[model samples]
Target: MYIITVEYVIDPGHMLTFMDAVLENAETSLHKEQGCVQFDVSQSHDNPTQFFLYEQFVDEVAFQQHVESEHYLTFSQKVQPAVVSKSVRHWYSC
Candidate 1:
């Protein structure tokens, strides 16, 4: 599996909006993409503005498809302005 993990720090004022957009994106990706294996969203216990995403795909091509997906593009545009900081990492199953 090709795995992707993301950590995000969002503006406090935009927390609710960001959550809604992200959740929708997750749901849409899982339902619409054949290569999308798993999508998980997490919030930090200590910080309400902190969020994380765990995504698994069949391969690198699958991951690429996801980034180009309409839902992802919409989600990116919706949340970009609200993001304070972001980090992403990729991995493969052993």
Candidate 2:
């Protein structure tokens, strides 16, 4: 599987809005994309403004499709302003 991990530090003022948009994006991706295998969202225990996403796709093409998806685009645009800092990493199953 192609794996993607994303970490975000969100602006505190936009936490609730960011949460809603992210959850909706996750749900939509899982339901709409055949290549999306897993999509997990996590929040830091110590810092409510920090969030993480763990995503798995069938292959690199699948992961590409995910980034091009409408839901993802919407999520990205919607949350861009609310993000303080972000990091993304990619991997593949052995």
Candidate 3:
């Protein structure tokens, strides 16, 4: 199994807009992607401008396909201006 976590730091003023975009992306993945086992988004209480996303895919290939998907590209383009910083971590089960 594979797991990934992505965090984004956005300008405080754009938090709401970014969250909306994230919600749209999450909905699309949940309904449309077969390999997407889990897709979740969370907000940091300590830092309102920060957001966390957790994703689980059947394997690396599945995750790669997700990255190349039209929905992902659209989300990335839509949120680029609002995002100030981002980080992604990948992990695998033993």
What lDDT does model 1 reach?
A: 0.97
Per-residue alpha-carbon lDDT of candidate 2 for residues 1-94, written as tens digits (9 for 90 to 100): 9999999999999999899999999999899999998999999999999999999999999999999988899999999999999999999899
Q: Please report how far candidate 3 places residue 8 from its true position, in Å.
A: 0.8
Stretches off by above 4 angstroms in model 1 are none
Worst 10 residues of 2 by lDDT: 62-71
User: Model 2 lDDT vs. the true structure?
Assistant: 0.96
In model 3, what are the clashing residue pairs, if there are any? none
List the candidates' TM-scores in order.
0.98, 0.98, 0.94
Runs of candidate 3 exceeding 4 Å displacement: none
Off by over 4 Å in 2: none
Worst 10 residues of 1 by lDDT: 69-78
Candidate 3 per-residue C-alpha lDDT over 25-77 given as tens digits, one digit per residue, 9 for 90 to 100: 98898788888899999989998888999999889998998899999999999
Full candidate order by lDDT, most accurate first? 1, 2, 3
